[model samples]
Target: MFARRALRAAAPAFAAGAAACGATTAWLADEADAGMFVVRPGLSASEYKPLVVGGVRQHTDGTTRVRFVMEEPDLELGAVAAAHLMAKASIDGAEVAGRVAPVSPLTAKGYFELAAAAAGDSAMSKAISSLKTGDVVQFKGPVQGFQVGRNQFKSVGILARGDGIADALQVATKLLSDPRDDTEIRLVYSVRSADQIVLRNHIDALALLHPRFKALIVADEAAPQWTGPTGPLSKPLLASILPPPTEGDSTVILVAGDVDAASGKATKARAAGVLGAMQYSPAQVRSL
Candidate 1:
């Protein structure tokens, strides 16, 4: 005991050591990032972290969604508002970014997702081409720019299309599961064709889960099985559902979809007086 006390007394008092130890101790799951994640625990903007491909889902639209699980079970890919991740398969490889899925972590717990093109010369396309189950891919981020002041909004709207709707759906689901006081959610999903309608089961479950929240689906051609609204997802249609958003960022509208759909819908939504149409792809994270 005397020798141990003498050693402790002789130990150098490195100020940074305490700070470093505090940093290490605060490495808990970032679910407590208020409403947005700016500082990640296991992930860094400058450091590249290796994640293994756990699975892949091939969508009918020639797009593929890859799922990567963190090496540690307790590790998490943070979420909400613009918190996102970027990944590269090999050194000097292409880079792809995606908002870590909400409600359900991509495919499984501790897993994150990235979207890749079927065929293209694009940087993201090239970067993810080699991804397969069990393969290692380097990840960067949890990068964020926008922050969400939860109580500031009177309501929230999500305009999404294609497979990208999955993320939006998850958000809606989370909102329903964990209702925000005095705030409402409006979710709209559009597909070019009825056959392209994926995740219908989850969508239906969410609709049933919270009847108060608006869930609208638009298809180019209405199929008999689809009991929801039909025709193109036009601003006129949305205008009927949601009053033109008032000024101020409080009226949050999350816009998700590919170039052909979301781009014009967002413009038209704004033209219809809808404000704060945040992009799910190009703006926050690129999975297209």
Candidate 2:
């Protein structure tokens, strides 16, 4: 009887151990699935850095070819952003400008040849086509890196559409323009100019509904002849958009431009002043 009782006691213990193991296994499985997850937050303007890659040759057509090695083939944009943040705390302040080899499965020769064929006759397309073996070209922008997770890597590879300086600037601008204080806004801007126009129109419509926005400032270089706010965006014009700064609340500036905010003293200085006044970067501006 004593032996039977002991066995009965041990049976529950064994079952409990088994249950614990099963739970652990399930947890591990779930974690494994989550390993490769990546979240692509909107790009930022302050992150733009001018990339200069040597040994890169541009084709007559304007396509550019670059050769670089990437250690992680599965890396996604989110992973790259995470890595960038780790390297630099303020992603908006620093820029990563260089042409390095893609990690794997995407050889330089293969990538350029395919890119050239796809690009056809565009300036960037021609530049990509001219890339010969072992060529390198520079990519300029606020380098937005990615975050790598278990079983997955995020990478916004150089040359991928929608990952350019203009796009980054649009995202940054939107964040700064957000009316809500606590809400986080994430967005992606397109490299295509037409998309930017559409975004500008949308913003104008929103302004009609919301009184906070007094006017929209568009860069003169790409300004259309539309009736609404269209012309060279100037500091005075931008200042007019925000209500006078109050003691507790501050004003924000939204700038949109293809010009490099760094490099020359003029652009850099202007950007700094704007950033301080607006408490945001150009990336926040949306086309609409």
Candidate 3:
């Protein structure tokens, strides 16, 4: 996770690429106060250009997963990963930050999934609420976020709630996929009910296959047939899940969801997200 400022420094290059891909002399401006990207002109802001919406799925628990085909043939998923890019979506004039996840191991051409928890009356929910197959949604990104060092830590502890599990998965996927990155990962997923748990099979499969990965799910309201831990993921739960920190600062905590109440960085355009929270401190912590 690199800072957005770093992405801005490379803005000229991004602008050039966008221009080559039907963008006309688009000017990139860093809204430093907002710590976000803003295209000054040349690109039509009012235009609702279409990106092929592949499909939309609603889970039994009300979570929504939207898949879109990246129409830009030049868009490289690997490049975005290497650059640590974060993106936002604009639909029905509502804009919200979104995270990209793998739809399939062997993605077909430029297809990927966009996930939103859509839990509350937030911008994300509003934008996602109106989504339909074939609707055109605009995206602006390749923006930067927190930067974790290359093999900097030996272990990562993730505490995620609600839709934030997507963020945890994003981090875990990167570290686990890198053969050279032998970092151990532990993830604690908290949700209101069993039905609310998303991507269980995927997470479970990763845990089963990867010796370095562990996943635990806690729900506030457990169904009669459910048998996992039940309760809020309070300090005690976290203490039990997180590994003790080793010397040389080889451990860090990454948090997402409901962090605003905890006075932690929450993926601000440039600042560390929940990773900057104080309670998880002494051990480094950041929000995604």
Query: How does each model score on TM-score?
Result: 0.59, 0.30, 0.65
List, residue by residue over 141-177, the lDDT tens digit for candidate 3: 3333344544768888877776567667767776676
Task: Go through the candidates in order and give each one's C-alpha lDDT.
Answer: 0.51, 0.27, 0.56
lDDT of 1 by residue, 143-246 (tens): 65234333446666676665446556655554454434345767777765565565566667666767657777777666776676777555567765542455
Backbone clashes in candidate 3 total 12
Best by lDDT: 3
Global CA lDDT computed for model 3: 0.56
Once fitted onto the true fold, the runs of candidate 3 whose alpha carbons sit more than 4 angstroms away are 1-50, 57-64, 77-109, 116-130, 246-248, 260-283
Clashes of 1: 0
Error of 3 at 194 (Å): 1.7
Q: Rank the candidates by lDDT, best first.
A: 3, 1, 2
lDDT of 2 by residue, 1-288 (tens): 000000112245554664564311011111212232222122223443222223343434333434332223322222121112111111223332322212111112112111222233233433433445543333212243321122121111111121132232233333223333222222222123322232244334534654432333332223344334433333454444433223112222222223322221113123344333544443322221
Looking at candidate 2, the ten consecutive residues that score lowest on lDDT are 1-10
Q: TM-score ranking from best to worst? A: 3, 1, 2
